[model samples]
Target: MKKIIFSSYLKLKSAPLAFMFALLFVAASCDTQDDVQPDSRALVSDNITAALKNNNWSAPGNSSAKERKPTFNTLLVALAKTGLTSTVAKEELTLFAPSDEAFAALGLYPNNIGNVPNLEQILLYHAVQGELYASDLSAGFVPTLNGAAVEVTLNGGVQVNGADVILADKRALNGVIHVIDEVLMPPTLNLVELALSFNPEFTILVAAVQKANLVNTLANDGPFTVFAPTNDAFVALLNELGFPNLDAVPDETLRDILLYHVVPGRIYSSDLSTGDVTAANEDTFYVNTSNLTITDANGREANLVPSLLNVQATNGVVHVIDRVILPELGN
Candidate 1:
C-alpha cells in the first residue's frame, strides 16, 4: 500500500505579477514507491456458528486470536441494529472493527446508534463487501456497501481518517477483523466534508470554497485533483499582498485563485512530475522538483509544501498545498 504522508505546506513570501512562459522540465529524482497494495490473505471461510463457538473470545490476552480485545456485546448490538447480524454471521467479509472504548471515547452509545444521521452508513463503512486481510488494504478509496467510500491511508502506521489500525488480521468465522483505534465516519457533503474529515486544519480551505461559490462544483463530480492550500498558505498570501486578510481580495479574484489549484482528473502523488501541467481552467503552470515547487505563468513561485499528500476521495484526490496557485489575469 502506498503510504499517504500528511505534512503541512510552508508559507511563501512573493506574489507572481507577470507571466513567464517556459519549457517543461522533468527532474530526474528518486522514484517514490507507490504503496497501493491489497492484503493477500483471504477472508475466514469457516461456518460462523462453529468459529464463534470454538473461539474463546473472552480471554483478553489470548494468542489464539489477535492480541486486541473484541467488543463482543457492542458488536452484536450494533449488528442487530443495522440488521446485518445474520449476514455478517454467514458471509465472508472484513470488518475493521473499532473497540468499545473507541465508541466511548467518541461519546456514542449503542442505544443511540439509530439516532445518528448516518449511523447505519457509518457501521457499514467498517465492512468491506468481500473478504480482505490487512494486506488487502491499499492507498485509495475503497467503497462500502453503504454507498460511501472510506480512504485507506497506509503510511508509517495504517490509518483510516487519522485513526491507526491497532491490531490487524484477526480471523473470525465469517470474516477477518482489524481492530481500529477510532470510529471512522463516512464522507458527506461532497468535497467539503472530505476536506474537513481528512484534516481539520483545512477549515480555511472549506471557508474559501464557500466564499468562492465553488462548493457545489467541487461537490459535483469528475474526479478533480485539488492542490488545496492550508490556512497558513492563505495568511501568507495576504501578508505578501499587503492585505489584512483574504476578505480584502475580490470574490472573483479569490474564485480564480482557488480554481487554479484544481485539475480535472485524479492525479496521485506517484503520477506527479516536474513539468508544465495544464490545470482545470486550461492554464498551464510549471512544477519543479515534481510538485515540491510550482511556478505560474507570471514568474510567481508557490512552493508545494503539503502537510498531507495523496488524500484519496471517491471522486478525486486532494494534495494539501501550502500556498494558493493564482491564475493569469486574462485567463
Candidate 2:
C-alpha cells in the first residue's frame, strides 16, 4: 500500500514538470513570432506634430497664432475659402498665414471683398505643398503648389516675401503653420506687364513685346529674371539716341533690346554678383556698375537700377530696372 502511494506522488510531480515545459515552449514561440513582425516608426507627418508640441504651441504667448486674434481669423477664413480645410484637417501643412491686420494694412480686404479676382491666387501664395517646419526652411527658393515659388530668406528668422515669420514653428494635425505679418502676392506680370506697372518709359518696350508676339511666352512658365529698366532710364536712353520713343527704332532693334534684359534663370536679389554676368541671349552683362548697370546692344550704357527688386512670381523673378538694354544694336 505504501509503495502504491509513492508511485502516485511521483506521477503527480512528473505531470507538473511536463506542464511547466509546455508553458516555456509557448512563451518562446511568442517571442520568435514577435521577432518576425515589422518594426514601426513614426511617419514624417507625425514627426512634424511631435516637434511642434514639444515647442509648446499649445502653451500661451509662446505661439504668435495664439497671441494675435485678427491674423488667426484671416488664416481660418483663407483656409476655408481655398478649399484647404479638409487638407489642413487631414494631412500636415505648414501655413505661412498672414494676419487680418496685415490684410487690412495692405488694403486687401477693404470693405468690399467680393470684387477681388486674385483672392484665390493670394491664398495660394501663402501655402506650400508639403509640410515644412521652421527648421526645414533654408536660404533658397521653395516652390508652392500655386505654381509660384516663395523665396525662403532665412537670415535671423524666416522671411517669406518681405514679411517676417514672427511666430516660427506652430504645429497642426495636418501640417505646420508659421504666422507672417504681410500677405504675399504673386507678381503675375511678364516683362511687359511688369514694365507697365511702374515704368511708363517702357511704353516702347511694351509695343515691341506686342510686335514680337512674345507676350504669352514671357508670361508662361518662366523663372526669367528680367533686369527691367525704369521710365527715366528709357527716357534717358531715348534722349541719348535723339529718339522720342521706341517707335522711332526698328521692330527688330526693340526686340533685341527687350531680350537683352532677360536671363534664363530666376535670379533673386541675393543671387546677384558685382561682376560681369551673361544673359540668356549669350551676351555678357555687367552688374559691377554702381546702380547695377548693364550695357545694351546699342553700346548705350543703361543703368539697371531696379525699381522693384525681388519681385517673385511662380515662373521667375522680375527686377524692374530703370533703363532698357538694347543688346543687339551695339549702339
Candidate 3:
C-alpha cells in the first residue's frame, strides 16, 4: 500500500496566491521536510457521506445534471464537496470540466478530492472569472478564477495547458463548460511534490525517487524535464526484470533508471524536436516528433500519451509516458 505521508509531502507549506502557482512554489522550496503546515483550504471531508453533511448540500435546481446529462459527475461531486457547486451553478463563469479519465491520468481518484490540501485552489483554477466560449479563446494565457493564468493553445484542436479540449461549449444556465481530456495543474508544485501528492498511480515512481534519494535534487533549483511513468509502467518493468517490487531492485540500478527519465532543463512538449536527447544518466533516447514517442537503447518505445503531456511543475515539468525506458545497464 502507498504511504499516507507521501500524500502529505506537499501539504507542508502554504501561500496566499489565491491560485497557488509561483507563489506556492517559493513557499514550498523554503519548507523543511519536518515542518508540515496545516492547510485550512482543504475540504474537511473524505467521502461523499461526510461531504454531503459538512457542505450545506443542495441539489442543482434546473436539472442541468440531466441536460448536461451528468457529463461531469466527478467534477460535480468535487464542486459539492468544496461547497462550490451552488456558486458555479448560479454564477456567470466558464468552467473547464475534466473528464474522469483526465483525473485518473493525473493520479487523482475522485474519492480523494477532499484529502487534497489545495482542493479549492485546484477547482478554482479550472474556472475563469467570466464566460469564455471557444471563439473567445485565443492562443495565450488567460486569467482563471484562482488568480493564475493558463495557456490556451489554438494550434492543434484547441489545447489548454497542453490538454486537448475534447468537448466544448456545453452551455449551462450559469456558465459555459468545456470538457478537457487532462487535468490542469497549477504551477505551484515542483516535480517531486506533484508526484508525491498524487499517489498509488505514482507510488512506485515516488518510492523509487525517495529510495534513490533524488528528492532534494529535483525539488531545489531545477527546471529539469522529467519523463514520468505510471505505476502500471513500473509494474511491467518489475515483472520483466523478475523482481517482485522496487525494493528488490538495487539502489544504484534504481537511481540510474530514475535519472534516465530526467533531462537537465525545462523541455515542454511543444519544444520537442525529432532526434536524440541525452538523459540525466548520460544515456540517449530517440524522440520521434511524428508520433511523440521515445525509443530507448533497448529498442523499447514509449508513447507520450496526449492526456499526460506538458504537466508544468514549479521547478520543472513532467511528461507521462506509457513505459519505463531502461538504460543500457552494463555488467
Top-TM-score structure, candidate number:
2
Candidate 3 TM-score over all chains jointly: 0.48
Tens-digit lDDT track for model 3 on 15-116?
A: 344545764454555554334332112322223222222322222234534333223556667887899877776677888878666776666676876677
Q: What is the TM-score of candidate 1?
A: 0.55
> Roughly what TM-score does model 2 have, to 2 decimal places?
0.62
Off by over 4 Å in 3: 1-150, 155-186
Give, for candidate 3, the lowest lDDT window spanning 10 residues. Answer: 39-48
Better of 1 and 2 by TM-score: 2
Ranking by TM-score: 2, 1, 3
lDDT of 2 by residue, 1-331 (tens): 4455446556666577777576557666766765554221222333332432333334224554654433345455555565665555665466777766777776656344434667777666777877787778788677665656788886777798768887765655557778777888876665556656655656655666787666886777466887766556667778878887767867676666677777887777666778767776677776754566665545556555455677765567777665666555545
lDDT of 1 at 248: 75
Q: Give the Å error, residue 144, model 1.
A: 5.4
The lDDT of model 2 is 0.65
Task: Give the 10-residue window scoring lowest on summed lDDT in candidate 2.
Answer: 38-47
Error of 2 at 153 (Å): 6.3
Report how far off residue 281 is in candidate 3 (Å): 1.4
